[model samples]
Target: MMSFDLIGRLFGSVRDRDGRADVLEKLAQHEPTLPAPRNPSAPEELLPVALATKVLAGWLANRQQTLVPHTLNFRVLGPAQADLLLAVMAAAIQADGEIDSREARQLSLALRRVGAGEDEARRIGAMLAEPQHLGTLLTRIQEADLATHAYAAALLAINRGTRVNRAFLDYVSARLGLVPDVAGSLERRYRA
Candidate 1:
C-alpha cells in the first residue's frame, strides 16, 4: 500500500521531481497500492525465452547422459557453443527460479556422464560462476557458426521438448539465417 513517492524517497533513482509528481498524482488518483518490488540485479527476475533456450541447450549438450560410456571430452563441443552454453546454464541455476537439489545432482552427474573429466568439469563450473546477463548470453548463442548452431539447437529441442514450439524454432532459425530443415533435423534428432 506504500505510495511511489514514499518508496521513491527511500530509493534514490526516482529523483525527477516533475516525473515523480506525475506518477504520484496518478497513484493518488487511482489510490493504488505498491506492487512487489524486484531486485534490480537478480538473475531470477529475467528469464527471457531466448535465454532459457540457450541455457537448456547448454545443459543438454554438455550435461545430458549419453548411451555409450565415452571418455570425458571437452573437444566434443567447439568453443563458441561451449561458452554460450556455460553462460546460460550459470544464469539459469542462479535465476530466482527453483532448481531442485535432485535436478542439480542430476545435472552434475550428467556433466560427468558426458565424459567431462574433472578438470574440464571444474573449468565449466567456473564459467557457470561468472556473472553475465541473459541477453548477452543469448546473443552469443545466436552468433555461433552453423555447426555450433546445429548442435545447440539439437540440445535445446531435447531439453525443451514440447516447449519448443514452431515460433521458437522459427525465431532461432531466422536468427541463424539457416534453412528450416536444419532446425527441423535438430528437433528430430533430439526429440524428447
Candidate 2:
C-alpha cells in the first residue's frame, strides 16, 4: 500500500487550487492527518511527500498503473540500491555544476528515508563530493527494478528542467539499459 501522505502528494499538486483541495480532501478521507501544503511553495510540498510522491509517480507512469491513495505504502529501498539512488540523485543535482541547498536537502531527506547507515552515507557522501562517472556508477546494477527506481530518483532530483539533466538522464537510462522511453516518459510527466 502507498503511504497516504505520499498519495496525497501524488494527487494534490497536479491540479488547480480548487482541484487540489478536492484531491486533498479525498486524500484526507483516508489520512485525516494530511495537512494542506503549508504555503504556495508547497505546490512542491503539496507533495511535501515530494521525493516519494514524485518517485512513486514516476514508478506508476513507467508501469502504466494506478493505486488507491489510502492503501499506499512507500517502498523502502535496500541498502545497496539506496546507496546507488543517493549517488544517482546527488549526481543529477550536481550535473549543472552546483547543488542548490534545497536540492541537497531533498536528497538528504531521501537518504534518511532510505535508512542508509552512517558508514554507507559517509561513503556515498565522499563519492558525491568527487566527480562522478554516471555510466560507471550504474554498471553494477543488473536488476530492472533497481534501474527504474534509480532513474526515477535521479529524475526527481533535477532542480529544474536543465539541459544538463536532460543529457544526464539520457546517459543514465542508457547506462541502466532502460527502454529509451523511460527517461523521456518520466521527463515528460514530471519534469515538464
Candidate 3:
C-alpha cells in the first residue's frame, strides 16, 4: 500500500504536466521520497532474496537518467522493461557466491543518478560492499521458490500507472509458478 501510493506521487509530475518538456524536466530532476543511500556502503544485511529482488526491480523501474551528469538525452526504455533488465543483472550478480565490487559500484553510481546524495550513496555502498552478505542473499533467493514471483510483483508495483493488465500478471505468475491466490493478491494490490 505504501509503495503503491509512493509510486503514484513519484510520477505525479509526469501525470499532471500538460507539456512534454515540463514532464521530461520534472523527471530529470525527480527526487526520491524515501531515505535512500547517499553512497555505496555495507547496508543492514538484506537477507531476504524476495525483498531484495523487489527493491532492485523498483530501482530499475525508476531509472530516468544515466549516471553521468549533463548528459541530456534520456534512454528510450520504459520503466517496466528497464526493471526487468536490472532484475536480470542483479540476479546474475547475486547468483554466484560473490557480489562483484565493480558491479556494486556501478549499481551505486546508477542509483546516485536518481538523486541519492553522498550520505545515501555511502549507505547504499555499505549495503553492497560485502560479498559474503551478497552470497547469503543469493542463497536465500535461490531457496525462496517465489523469488521470481516476488520480482514480478515489484515490477507491477513500479508500472502500475500505465500498463496494469491481467495478461502481464498471468504471464508472470505462470512463469514463476506462483499460486493463484498470491498472484491474485499482487494483481489486486498493484493494479492502478
Clash number for candidate 2: 9
Residue-wise C-alpha lDDT for candidate 2, range 59-78, written one tens digit per residue: 77756423311111124555
> How does residue 88 of candidate 2 score in lDDT?
73
Name the regions of candidate 2 deviating beyond 4 angstroms: 1-63, 66-75, 109-123, 143-145, 184-192
lDDT of 3: 0.43
Best by lDDT: 2
Q: Compose the digit string of candidate 3's lDDT tens values, residues 148-189.
A: 434432332232232333344444456556657555544553
CA lDDT scores, all candidates in order: 0.51, 0.63, 0.43
Cα lDDT of candidate 1 equals 0.51
Q: Of the pair 2 and 3, which is ahead by lDDT?
A: 2
lDDT of 2: 0.63
Task: Evaluate candidate 3 by giving its C-alpha RMSD to the native, one decimal.
Answer: 24.7
